[model samples]
Target: MKHEMGRSDLLRRIQEVEFVALDINLYLDTHPDNMEALMDYNKYVYELDQLKRTYEMNYGPLLNFGFSPSQYPWRWIEEPWPWEI
Candidate 1:
């Protein structure tokens, strides 16, 4: 299912996965014994993590700080601001 994804598409996929995880999280809050939901949640979370890693590698930090490492004098600052583009 993997293909060349632009930044916007990748961001959309990441958000979609996280939203699914969040809904599952709410379901689990009331039914903590649901192993099936738990497994689904875990799968989505792992996919989200991989997406984030891919995003960071190709397009700077998805976050404003913290998750991004100081690889080369904070190149994130040089990336085009979302509002500017």
Candidate 2:
């Protein structure tokens, strides 16, 4: 049966996807003409965005400093700090 992912699971997924996207980004910097790599990069980027949005919606804002919007009473402050998470 499918199970719901916890906060830490979501965070881990985001980190993994982000790492893959960054690695592909660096590769593309050296091989700009690689269509396959470019396509892969785009796919991963889209996945990363979706994952972050899901995480934020379930938990809270993943970022501060105007990167992520807050809800009533400033929900960002309600979530645990990054280190605590």
* Best TM-score among the predictions, by candidate number: 2
Question: Per-residue lDDT of 1-85 in model 1, one digit per residue for the tens?
Answer: 4737988888888889989999999999999999999999999999988887887777777667576654466766866743344
Clashes in model 1: which pairs? none
77: Cα error in model 2, Å? 0.9
Error of 2 at 35 (Å): 0.6
**What residue pairs are clashing in model 2?**
none
Give the top-scoring candidate (lDDT). Answer: 2
After superposing candidate 1 on the true structure, give the runs of residues whose Cα lies further than 4 Å from its correct spot: 1-3, 81-85
